[model samples]
Target: MGKDQDLLHAVKTEDLLTAQRLLQRPRPGKTKLLGTAKRVNVNFQDTDGLSPLHHAALSGNKELISLLLEAQATVDIKDQNGDSSTAL
Candidate 1:
């Protein structure tokens, strides 16, 4: 599979340790880690500009969401459709 897909999979699987390692590594072949899309950082968006915190709110993954929020992710980050994080 493509490298980006692999990385995205790691994030979705909640393998935060591995995802952190991959993000810290220099991109292979000039690829960027964060992507041009901000939501890509934590796989937070679901066809919107919502952050992972938003998902946590909906799914009640409080611990994981707390970690993301603590990491300085933009709490008010808006998506392409103007959806911002209303997650608590």
Candidate 2:
């Protein structure tokens, strides 16, 4: 497994706090961090193209979700498979 892949997994595991701290640290290149408490799409699921909001929802992270929404994450953004919005 690669480093980015591991980060994605951590995001999916609802480890937003860990992810946030990691994202705060500098990376070598482009991998810009969103700084939002969203989950990572490690597998890149089509239907679950879930951003941090999706992760927060599944984990009941209302606070994180609010923060991501404030950061302007599309509330209606669908996954790769067009599974409607993460709000669903």
Candidate 3:
């Protein structure tokens, strides 16, 4: 699978290290690590329309939730069932 797919898998499996590494890559023409192109889109949804944030929150993984938030995951995104991370 590609890096983006790998990133989604990492988040689903709660693999914090991999997820963090992906998010930490430096963005082009930027010194900050927050906007890396190498990083997967935090807002990417699965077939069920659930974002990584939804998975993290649904699993009750507070640390993962925090990590995703730090990585700029959108908490307001809704799943297929209309459940946001906050609602999960």
Candidate 4:
């Protein structure tokens, strides 16, 4: 699978380490890591239109939720069923 697909899978399964690695870009050895330049889109939705935030929220994973939020996942994006992450 591609990086985007792997990222989505990591998020869906609540695999924090994999998700973090996918979201973080490796910097120059001495360069300080900055915010989200190479991070995956946290709001990417599946075929059903369910985003990572929606899955995280439904699974009650506060850590994953926070991570996705920090990555700028849109909480207001609705799924195929018209349910937003906040409403999940």
Query: Which candidate comes out best when scored by lDDT?
Result: 4
- Model 3, which residues run further than 4 Å from truth? 27-38
Worst 10 residues of 4 by lDDT: 30-39
Residue 31 error for model 3, in Å? Answer: 11
Query: How many clashes in each candidate?
Result: 1, 3, 0, 0
Encode model 4's per-residue lDDT on 1-88: one tens digit a residue: 6566677788788899998887765666756558535556777888999888888888898988888888788999999999898898
What is the Cα-based lDDT of residue 52 in candidate 1?
A: 55
Error of 1 at 69 (Å): 1.1
Residues 23-76 of candidate 1 have per-residue lDDT tens digits of 453546876656543323554454554555565555565555566666555677
Q: What is the alpha-carbon lDDT of model 2 when measured against the actual structure?
A: 0.53
TM-score of each: 0.45, 0.47, 0.80, 0.80
- Deviation (Å) of 9 in candidate 1: 5.2
Residue 16 local lDDT, model 2? 66
Q: What lDDT is reached at residue 1 by model 1?
A: 44
- Ten-residue segment with the worst summed lDDT in candidate 2? 39-48
Show where candidate 1 strays beyond 4 Å. Answer: 1-46
Overall lDDT per candidate, in order of appearance: 0.54, 0.53, 0.79, 0.81
Clash count in backbone of candidate 2: 3
Relative to the true structure, candidate 2 reaches a TM of 0.47
- Over 52-74, each residue of candidate 2 has an lDDT whose tens digit, in order, gives 55555667767566555554555
